[model samples]
Target: MAGVTAMTVQLNRMDRVSPWGFRLQGGRDFRMALSVKKVEPRSPADGQLHSGDAILAIDGYDASQMTHAQAQQMIRNSGNTLQLTVNKGLFQSLKPTGPIKFSPAAAYGYSHGHSTF
Candidate 1:
């Protein structure tokens, strides 16, 4: 993570429109669907997404075939009604077995008081 890990995540059409407030990160090869790195508070994705949850798609576009830009554009153009298919099992597997020792900030990919998102 040398440069800022950037990806545009937008929310579904609702009473309030806001950024989905989640960071999507993964290797560019698309061998696997991108994973949710963080979910911001009170955003549309906060309760529905979790860190490490594999994103299967946005709307009906398969995430397996998308580049970062394509994914971003798709979400931005989805008319405020983005639908996310998430794999919660993957997220559970990524969780620590013992009590969490790291700070919440660190867990969400914060480094040196700066957020990567």
Candidate 2:
């Protein structure tokens, strides 16, 4: 947890049918991490949450091992009030490197792929 910083956010659902007003990124396939990708303007999470904030838990349940679908379901199931525990620094620490180009022949050493430099 060297780069992790945790904080809690509470969101109030205007009604049963209203949207959560935030978008998420990352999943088992992507990186086994969940992060806030977008916060709709003037929404409940607008000021409380931020893009790239890593979700550490939903309510009191751990979210580190959850898939995107599972996490979504958990949020949806949370009625009225939704409490989130997030790591504001975790996502920044996990930043992706620039695009890497590779050639099929590079594996066999037939041709050297472009260097990251």
Candidate 3:
């Protein structure tokens, strides 16, 4: 606490600071993590995934290690299109997209195919 003035903090979408904070300059860890879990049939998961399927990653970041609280915050912060690094039961991949697609003609939203990151 000596010689401390102010701290720049990064909060999750939920407005909570990481209870566990580690500061290692230029630190990086490549660990598989689960980030998002979209069980909506309108999502890429749809019938392809079941209720409990854990959607991992966003674009190329492993989200599995992230706790559920972390995951929720990231999802909300990502603005809809999330590029994740995912790993599931044996199928691993990246998906960048939104929950629903907007149709000009229909003036409504519909499910769109998951795009490759």
Leading candidate by TM-score? 2
RMSD of each: 10.3, 9.5, 17.9
Residue 39, candidate 3: Cα error in Å is 1.8
Candidate 2 on 27-103: residue-level lDDT in tens? 65345588887678777777888877888899989988887767777888888788999988456424437864774
Question: Clash number for every model?
Answer: 1, 0, 13
- Ranking of models by TM-score: 2, 1, 3
For candidate 2, report its TM-score: 0.72
lDDT, candidate 1, 1-117, per-residue tens: 243232334356463345766777642343445677777888777777778776677776678767655666666676656677766636422334687666764676643221122
For residues 1-117, write the lDDT of model 3, one tens digit per residue: 344232112222223221211110100122333322234434333334332223455344455465444554554456424443322333233444676465552464412212111
lDDT of each: 0.59, 0.71, 0.33
- Cα error of candidate 3 at position 68, Å: 0.9
